[model samples]
Target: MEPPGNATAADKADAVETRHRAVLRKFIVRARRVEEHSLAADKERLLAWARGTVTLKFEPQSGNSTMTWDLPEEESLDSLAARCRPFLLQGDPVYHGKVTNALGFFLRLAPDELRNYLREIRESWRPLDPGDRETIGYESRTGSISQALGDLVTDKELAYAWLYGDLVHADDNGEERLHGHDIDARFQAGALLITNVAVKAISTLNLARAAQSQNYLTLEDSVFTERVVARPKREVRVEKFATAPVGTPPAEIEAALDGVVPRPDSSKD
Candidate 1:
């Protein structure tokens, strides 16, 4: 979009630059929020699952379950990815026609050094080599495992497959492909990719801010936050129950464990 008709060429260029800066700043702020609330909030849990410190267990007599620390009930990671879909979404904004991605913003407006750094961060999301049989492995639903010798899948592919297939919308082929897999592992793996994206965004913003301070970036200071005050950090608290609360009725306990323990209706079958 052109500036006012009376504006000079320099004024028009400045207007465009200012608008780009504003969008870049917005992406940075959103990235920080996602990092803190979505990723950081579940960092330990994600890592635990990724490293197999915590795992899902299925009881032959009962059913499958994740540990309390795993936070099986929390959907923030998946939901956050869904909410930030536009960051990875391709194409330009409908009306603005400006790029709406962190990497794109950096590539278009940032210095060469900063742009390269962001690019590297993005590339890190891709697997080192899809055909590396030694590192990559595959397992089917039947518990058979084999080396990923051919047609190996990359981290990006697996992550997006899970994201589009299971969480966001049910893509028919994606669903079939992911069928009969360890659901928690798939979810966590996809979340790791999402984490990379969040990290890339936050890193880009921080680097841009640092570049501006160092005069590597010559943009006006209006695009960055002036005073970022840190709020007091809250402590995480967990309450535990060894068994049903004292004085709880048998029927209430049964109701509480309705799904975990089979109900009369289900057992009848």
Candidate 2:
């Protein structure tokens, strides 16, 4: 039965979906659970959005702790850039939000990565520090990741496990070289977040819709929470299955075999 009010079940669904998409459209991050083949397209989309040729308008939703926005078709890139120019290249929360979403979408990064990503951003602010900047490069298609940071993009085991956790991939035995979400990209993604050209341009365009009134996007470490509350379901499942009975064929029973094979002498015997 439908609930009484202006809002019905279908209305709620539409509201939730609209909220979901409104949330997605505000960030430059790739969509969660995107198929590997579609990543190329996502990459292109991000590039185009960054380039500022895309048409969009800023429309903030009703909230403050988290600001939600909808993108509408309108205006030029110059107008978009004007809005973000103040926040550009600065350690802004809006900038951080984009990076967080990117890592969450691409790496499905561990809860700890939140700290690491923040540190990376703060570290990028110092122009004199040639350490990580030299070590990590732009257009670096291939290299090993710093355990201090992340692993190699070529690590299929890691990629497969992450993708599987997200339910995006199942088969682990892919002999072919798959396109990996590289550390450089992941690092560069959030890390560029001392807000360089790519980050400034892309993130501005992405969040242009909501940049006027913004706060941090909520991201929780659900995995860590699960680990803390997780119970021993496996043992209980095993016990239940073990007690399940299979019908015995009396004709085929080895009733005499126990005696013939020399069963242990019973105390009652």
Candidate 3:
């Protein structure tokens, strides 16, 4: 995992762990055979849309692995952590304790601070008592605590880096690059939650309006005939896990999706 040009060697090393371990979830969004003009415009549009501090996990896919970004938002850590308490304490007490402990360790807060936070969490945990017999509702909020904690941590680190000018950068070389500011943030833990948030957010966006607003540039050279045929294909390949420590890399997750489902080879007649 080499860092992009313009990045320091230390930055590259930091990025390997930060990007690989911290990503919680990944989404693959693709548009095929769009007009070349539209494609170029779309790429720019996507980059602009992605800019800014939002609490989400995003990374553009390349050949082998993806470089994940932890978007920031204006939310306090305690508030966000409170939102996730119910989800953390839902089913089993033991599991809830484990989650709370993990979060405490990650936040580096004292026992007293953890207790105060848990007190606030307990105070706010009354909604589940209302007996709302809805499966979707439960699932929807099941990961709230984890999600909120993840968001707060990401935002906090990003905000600090932004203020101190300690953020890492990589050149945009027509490919994806990873940032390596917070190597110990455990982004992978929050990946799924942030991804869900991103999906819901994108669902409400008007892409057609975006397309219309951007001026598409034409190649003015290449042309395609009307009879061109495109084939739909899907394939799955499994490989042995020989990467970093288990659970340290994205591939260690039991539910993480890996590899490309290549499009079928096409033959011209």
- Give the TM-score of each candidate: 0.51, 0.19, 0.16
Residue range 1-269, candidate 1, lDDT tens digits: 76889999999878876666666655555655555654456665544533334355667777756543243333877766754555565342311113233335435655777667656655543331222222212332323456333333444456666677678888752444544444555664566556555544555556666656756555656546443334688676755323677997677676555535534655565
Q: Against the true structure, what is every candidate's RMSD?
A: 17.7, 22.5, 26.6
Evaluate all candidate structures by whole-model CA lDDT and list the values in order: 0.53, 0.33, 0.30
Worst 10 residues of 1 by lDDT: 128-137
Off by over 4 Å in 1: 2-12, 41-74, 92-119, 122-152, 215-269
* C-alpha positional error of residue 181 in candidate 2 after TM-score superposition, expressed in Å: 36
Candidate 2 C-alpha lDDT tens digits along 21-132: 3433433222111111121235554344333232344446733243222221223222222333333323443343444343344323334544355445445433212222
Model 1 pairs whose backbones collide: none
lDDT of 2 at 227: 33
What lDDT score goes with residue 23 in model 2?
A: 38
Q: Candidate 3 at residue 87, lDDT?
A: 38
Tens-place lDDT per residue, model 3, 1-269, is 56789999899867753432222111001111222112123444333323422344445564354444443232322222223322333453322233333333323433464446544443333222223232111121112433532222233233223322322233231111113324223232232232222222232112211221331211111211232224457566857333445455453433233443434448833
Error of 1 at 177 (Å): 3.8
- Model 3 misplacement above 4 A: 1-66, 73-78, 91-185, 194-269
Rank the candidate models, highest lDDT first: 1, 2, 3
Would you give me the overall lDDT of model 1?
0.53
